[model samples]
Target: MPTLLLVRHGRSTANTAGILAGWTPGVDLDDTGRSQAAALVDRLTGVPLAQVVSSPLERCRQTLAPLVEARPELGGPTVDERFGECHYGDWTGRPLSELALDPLWRTVQDHASAAVFPGGESLRALSHRTVAAAREWDEKIAAEHGPEAVWAVCTHGDVVKAVVADALGMHLDHFQRINVEPCSVTAIRYTPQRPFVLRMGDTGDLASLRPRPAHGPTASGDAVIGGDTGDTGTP
Candidate 1:
């Protein structure tokens, strides 16, 4: 089996404001975000990573910049639009406060799995795209480098959740069941058989925030941070 490491981009100004930046473009990571990326780099310093792929967004690329610089032998990170954030359509760059005031906003917050943005891609659609892209990448790795290839992908939070849900064979309705934090690293194992999410939404120790190699396979299907369920904040 091959290992796939999925990392969410670090905190951004828009993220702090709780606004939907979507594909508005040019959003950069903040200071704390840079620190988190550095932490990740420290963690993965000893790990042998085969390839690194990231969203075309500046934030995603920046998240992997340091790692590429440190390990020039690993080559440059590949840019793929499929790993980009979910297109918020009409809500792009809108203030979260204003959007929250709308009735539809509640539905989005509560049941985003099925809710569709007025002019944006549906959550389900986003999940499908992510899953397909991931599968293609897995196949390419297997064909080009054999079964032991380990790859890292840098993407947005929502996109990571969608990909996680799809990998776990969960329905779109369970989108909220997974919460992807900025600069978090979630590891999974993908095989020809169904996708097995060995781990999901784990930021690892704050002390080592940068990308690192996983020591062992997931024995239990669990998450480090529990998601906020409608009825209760439970995993």
Candidate 2:
């Protein structure tokens, strides 16, 4: 068994501008986001990460920079596209207000398992791939670093939500009920029986959440959301 730390990238330029970043390129951390990234080092001070994985996108990479710099023993982050942001396809860089008015918006809020972006992936597909990828990595890390191994994966908001939903044994449609803020940390430990979620959308200390034995375990709709943080807006 291993402790998997799920981290949502910090706020970005797109977030402040109210844009949905999706897989869009050139999205970097905003001033506030840089502060959040820097603060992450302190937050994760005592947690020893055997491996640091990340989405191949810019924001996720930027978010992990500080941690990578501070934790040299962990080397660099291994990029895994499966853990990347859900493909929005045609909806990739649109405004949240515009997307809210789309016919699919209600489905996203109500029955996410059935909601697929016009030219992109479905929510069900998202959960399937992300959940599988997490477990695969968990097993690999455990074999390589030992059962007490601890790892961190820096990914997107919806991706984080989907993983959390699966760990909680909730249906995909209810994944929207979870909200993870920028730089938040969500930890899950996989055991022979089930996955235990140690923390959910935590924005505080990681010292308390350090690797242990088998443990148990944002936004939008009324407001707005992004792939990086609130992944509800665009590039």
Candidate 3:
């Protein structure tokens, strides 16, 4: 089996603005996010990736731009919609504060398995597709690139959380306990016997802040607004 590097996209303007940004058009990386993306090139210098995958979302593309530029042999990231951000429907582009007040907010945080965005997709569906995509890609990569080959998937926070939870054999409802900061690198290795989560939220010496409970219902989870802003407030 192949080792998978799960990377969340860098911070975006929406992140700084406290918006959910789900499937929002024109959402790109902020200055801090660009810096984080560039720094990623140096951080993974030696680990050669067999393939670099990405979500079609602009932010994810921008996050991996520097890396692709540095390693042209990887031939850029192959777009994988299955790894895109969770569709928030009516919740898209809304301020996290207001969204936190919605009744579904509690379900998203406490019982994600039952979460279904209005006019959007369900958390259960998101989990199924993403996990299946991961397994499919992992098997394909191993067969094509060899067992020692490594690869990466540059995607969103929730997707990472979902995949990480599945790899850990934890229920989706308990996935809130797993967090991956923006531009962080999480490594997981799959063996014939089982899958192992080698790392989670491995940002390189990046000083950052995570919102406290007072922030909101998703204060500690991936509904992250202030949590990954790199701002100094409420650390």
- Which segments of model 1 are wrong by more than 4 Å? 205-235
Candidate 1 vs 3: which has more lDDT: 3
Candidate 3 lDDT at 50 equals: 90
How would you order the candidates by TM-score, starting with the best? Answer: 2, 3, 1
* TM-score result, candidate 3: 0.86
Q: Which candidate number would show the highest lDDT if scored against the true structure?
A: 2
- Report the C-alpha lDDT of model 3 over 1-235, residue by residue, as the tens digit: 5678899999999999999999999999999999999999888865768999999999999999999999989888999999999988899999999989999999999999999999999999989999999999999998998775678999999999999999989999999999888999988767666676757999984222121123432222234444444333443
Q: Tell how far residue 215 is off in model 1, in angstroms.
A: 14
In model 3, pairs of residues that clash are none
Per-model tally of clashing residue pairs: 6, 15, 0
Q: Rank the candidates by lDDT, best first.
A: 2, 3, 1
Task: Give the TM-score (vs. native) of candidate 1.
Answer: 0.84
What is the C-alpha lDDT profile of model 2 across 140-202, one tens digit per residue?
A: 998999887789999999999999999889998998899999999999877776777778999
Residue 150 of model 2, lDDT score: 82
Stretches of model 2 off by over 4 angstroms after superposition: 213-235
